[model samples]
Every structure is written in C-alpha cells, then in structure tokens.
Target: MNDVRLYSKTDFSKCQLTQHPLYSYIQTFLNHDISCLVENCRNATCYAIEFGKELILVVDAQFQAGQTYPTSLRAQYLDYAQEELALTEIKGQKLLSGAFRLLKTIVPQKIDEAVYVGNYLVSTNLFPNFTLEEVQAIELLLNKHFPNKTIVYRSQNSFLNQELMEHLDVLDYQPFISRQVFIAHQAQVIKRKKSFKKDCKLAKDTMFDIRIDFDVENYTERIIELYSQLYISKYSKINPLYTTVFIEAMTDAQNTQFIGIFDDEKLIGVTMSWSFDGVLTVPILGYDLSYPKEAGIYRLLTYFTLLRVNDEQIFHMSSGVGPFKLSRGAEYFPEYIYYKRVPSAKGYTCSFWLLQKLNKILIRISKKKVF
Candidate 1:
C-alpha cells in the first residue's frame, strides 16, 4: 500500500461481514478512532479482514512514506491474551488474543519503525483452550518492528509475564508500569441485589412515578439532559466524539438499551447500558442534580436496573473517579492500560515509564478511601 488514506466510518460499514461496534464507549471516552485522532498527521486507511485468527481489527496506520510492504514484515503484536481478554480469562472465560495491539506495534517514525493497531478479542463465538504462546507471537512481532521499543502491559500478573519472555523473546519487555487496575465487570459473581426504599418514597412524594425503561429513544432529550448535568460541571469537559448526533446514534432502538428514571409524567434520570452476546456494558449514566442533598436517584437507578437485568453475571461497569460509584453498592475494579516506547528511537521510553509508576502509586493510594 502506498500510504494509508482515511476511510470514513460510513465507508467501512459497507464491508462484508462488518459489524459496526456500539461506538458509545469509544465515542464517549476517546476523542475519535485512529484516523480522527491523527487527522493532522499522515496515517492509514486500513481495511479489516474480519476479527481473524489471533487478531480482530487490523488498523494499518498506512505504511512508511517510501517503504514498500516488504515481502517479510518485521513487526510486533499485542492482543487479548494480555489485555481485556486477559481479564476475561481471569474471570474464568476462555480467551484468545484478539483485542487491540497498538501498544505493541506503534514504533517511532525513523529506523524503519512502523506500528499497526489491532484488537480481536471480542468474538461472537468463544475461543477455547488459549495458551500463553499466542501472546508470545504478538510480542515477538512488535519487538521486531521497533527493535528498541519496550512492551509493557499493566494487566500482566507475574506468571503470564514469565511465559511471554522465553530466550527467543529477544526484545526487552520493560517494566514501564506497575499495579494497574482492571475495571470490574458488574456481573462478576452477583451478590444479593439491594436498593434503598427511602429513595423511592422521596420520588413518590415529589409526585413523579419512578419507572425504568429499556426503550431509551423514548426520552433521548431527557437522557441528554441528565447526562449534561453529570458531565457539564467543574470536573467535566466536552467530548467531541459524543455529540448529540452520536448520542442519537446510540439510541437507535436496534443498537442500545436505556434505563430511565421518570416521574409519573416527567423524566428525571437515565442510565444507558449495552450488551454483546454475553457482556453487558454501561457507558453513560447520570441523574438530575436537582436532588442535590440526596443520593436517592443515584442509588435508586442502580437498584432498579441491576435487579431488572436478566443476566447480571457478565456486566462491565465503567468505573472512574470515586465516592459515588464506590458507595452505590457496585464493587470496585482495576482497569489496565499499557504502552510501548523506545528511548533511543523516540526517546519517550524512560520519561513515560517514570510517569506511569508514580500514577499507579497515586491510584493505589487513592483507592484506600471510600464513602
């Protein structure tokens, strides 16, 4: 390929066997996918062949400006085995490496260092009997590409790390970070479900019936209204990825499920959750700040929705900040992130390494406090 050009999400949506992901999480949390994130810089217009063997989506950020797609690719890989999939396996589901691999493959511009992005972990069919060697292949490929870049993943427990570094694994898999948190899936071993009743009585007194609805489109404006109250505050900033249009896209009846807190006639709060074959994801949630003194809506929303869900055993709760989610009866979880850098090549290696270590330490220290 000459150089990867940009392909609009619409264009890619037309590919055969292409299933557009519920972009809520990415849209809500990330600025945009690879292309938009690098719009000002030169990048690739990659075509994914399907979440294939050991890989899901392969995003070629284009190729080197003058280099050819060499007959033999000196590349490195990272996938599910040590990422989100790694966490899944810890929870007892069979896993194969297929999530995203940008961390392993993104190399510096000079020195023939080119990076590729991939994540194939999310599969409709469960992959069975996964071994540690699959991750070895990913690491070897990534190291080959950068030569100097170090591969680091916070989700790795020691046993898995040793397996990744046999003598054949020549590249240095540096310890750039430690003790990262994997955000807990809400459905992992559900305990007895409970919701405080006093909150409901308060709603009843206010003359609004508290009803939860799966049909989110019925109240898109209200959903946005509550979301804005939660997000448009001193601690919040606007995310271009989650425009009103994107929110509407998520509400497309065919795509997402919503749970709303309503008065007999007025909408008061909303929580939006999504489902894959087995995993339920909560991407957006908020309550009206009008009830400032009481945590009623926050606690009430969780209870109603948690109890109503048919399968609560495999849910992924997006955990962040603290105090509120920590106390609302949802359990705490650690979310993991990894990075690759070459000190000599790009030279962000050591600087970033130190930064990650202190950040991890701070996070662990903060976790001690709960409401």
Candidate 2:
C-alpha cells in the first residue's frame, strides 16, 4: 500500500529526503525526498509526502503582502510568487494507482555533451514494481505507437521509490531513442499592479537606441538571431528547435509572452515564457554574443521581468541550474514523480509465451551494448 496524505504548508520540514526515491541534486529544491513532479502549465503546487509513513503536506505558492518565512519551509517562499496562481489539487488516491508513469515533465536547462537529450524528453517513467517481462511488454506496446521515439529503461528517481524499480527490473534495459530529455521552468507574471521600473544598461556611444517591445511580432526574428548566438556559443552541437518559424510559433502562443530588448534596430535578448491559467513560466532566454562587453542584456531583462511582474504573478525558477534567478529570491519547491503501468490486454493473455521470446532477445542485446 502507498502512503498518501495531505498536511499544511508547515509540515514540509518534517519531511525526510533520505528515504525518498530520486537523485541527490533534488534536495536543494524539495523539502523531502518523497516529492511530486508536475508540469509548469498550472499554478503548480508541491505536496510533500512520506511514502513510507503516509504523511503528506500540501503546500502552495501564495502572494500575500508582507509574507515571509524561513527558507527551509519551501512553501512559505512561494508567497513571493508574482500573482494568484491556482494549482491542481493533489488527488491523493488516484495518483497512487495510475496504470503507467513516466519521468521528465520537460527538459532541464543546462546541456552537456554526449548525453541523450531524447531520453530526457521521451522516456516513459514507470514505478519500480513490475518484473522484467512486464517492462518489455509495456515497451513493445509503446513501440507500436511511437516507432521513431527512443525509450530508455532507467532507475527510480530516488530511494523511496527504488524498490519498485528494482522489483520491475526496469533499470537494466537500454534506450531505443538516442536523446536525453531536458526539463525547465521559471516565473511568469501578469501585468503588475505596481509601476514597471527597469535599470537599463546602455552603452555610452551606441549606434542604436534601446527599446522594449511587448509585441512579439515586432522583434521575433531579431530575438532568434540574438538567441542563436548564445546557444551556439555555449554548445558546440546544436538542436534545430531554434529555427525562425519554430521560435515565432512558440513566442506567439496565446498563453505565452515573448519579451524582447532591442538595441535601436538590433534585438539583444529575448525571454520566451509559456503560460497556463495565470502562471507564465520562462522556458527559454537568449541573448546576442557580439555584445559581450554588454553582458547586461539578460540581466536587464530579468530585472525588468521581476519588477514588471512582481505585483501580479509568482515566478517559477526551476530546481536545476539557475543561479541567477534563484539568487533573485526564487526559492526551492520540491516536486515528485510517480510511475505505474499495467500491461496491455493483448500481451497479458500471452505473457508466458512472449516473456520467453522477449527475455532472450533483451539479454543478448544488453550484452552487445555493454561490450
């Protein structure tokens, strides 16, 4: 049986991370090891649960005047969010019994070499309880739907959930797709109640005048030109999601805000934020590199973002690799992910028959990849 209960925001500290099933890096963002991972689409709130004890704390981000709390109480800091964003209520029991679960709501910001970005983006996350045969059955089913996507059988996110992974024998399988998925989230704001104030950094003898555009259509191509520079500068290899049409489509979505900083005629940096409900999350930010002496492009944009959106909405700085945003009062909010899958009917009928064939092939392929 799974322990799923809800408590007030004050209970997050009582959470013990050592027992949860995830990686060590998450400790900075979550109050307990037993956390929940939700997409950045809604007023995402985090529920801290002690899977072993069934103890749970339902904490949400609230923006109240003069609200403050210790950093350790993860939810209290959520009060600093920019607006009144509502998140999905944790359906305690329903979550515990899902038929299938997958990891990676989105891709993390930082990119490293040789890591499979596809796996991070597309791997089907499952809990740690099924047998090896059961896992293969699931994969075979998915292959039928997404023949082009790669699937990796990876470990439980942390120890609290490790047993399920161990029991299922999922971590042993290799990835069919080559890329690792990356996930990220950040704060987005409605127009604030307060004034929009920004400390603009202008070069003393500039050829262009600096202007800000709320209309994305005005500076989209320019924004991409600037962003592509930062991306190419950082990563030796590039992902083609940066094409002009793609950038324009994402920037112009109804629930998104694509903020731009222009140097008279040239675009310097752009902040592309996605929205749902009232929460707007900055999923991507890019700047022009030729203006290295003016490294202030992104910094100026962020300040403008906070000051402009502070009074109305809360910003969602992600759990991974965002020191700049984190430093500007974005606090830690723990998230958890759960996976459970019941084999499809077609396979269940002939489990004994297919297991025999799939298991033999799996072992052989695994050895080939290893050697």
For model 1, give the 10-residue run with minimal summed lDDT: 120-129
Cα lDDT tens digits, model 1, 1-371, are 11122223445443343243523322321233442332222333332322222212333333344222210011111221233233322322232232224333443333223333332111111111123454455555555543653443333322223343332234443332222222223432223322234443554565444554455556666766677677444223221113344456566523356777665656777776656444455556778788764646676666555543344334444434444444434554433323444556554554344445544543544355321
Across residues 163-201, which tens digit of lDDT does each residue of candidate 2 receive? 544533443432121111212223332222121122332
How many clashing pairs per prediction, in order?
31, 56
Measured on C-alpha atoms, candidate 1 has an lDDT of: 0.40
Which is the leading candidate under lDDT?
1
How many steric clashes does model 2 contain? 56
* Predicted candidate 1, C-alpha RMSD: 12.0
- TM-score for each predicted model, relative to the true structure: 0.54, 0.38
Best by TM-score: 1
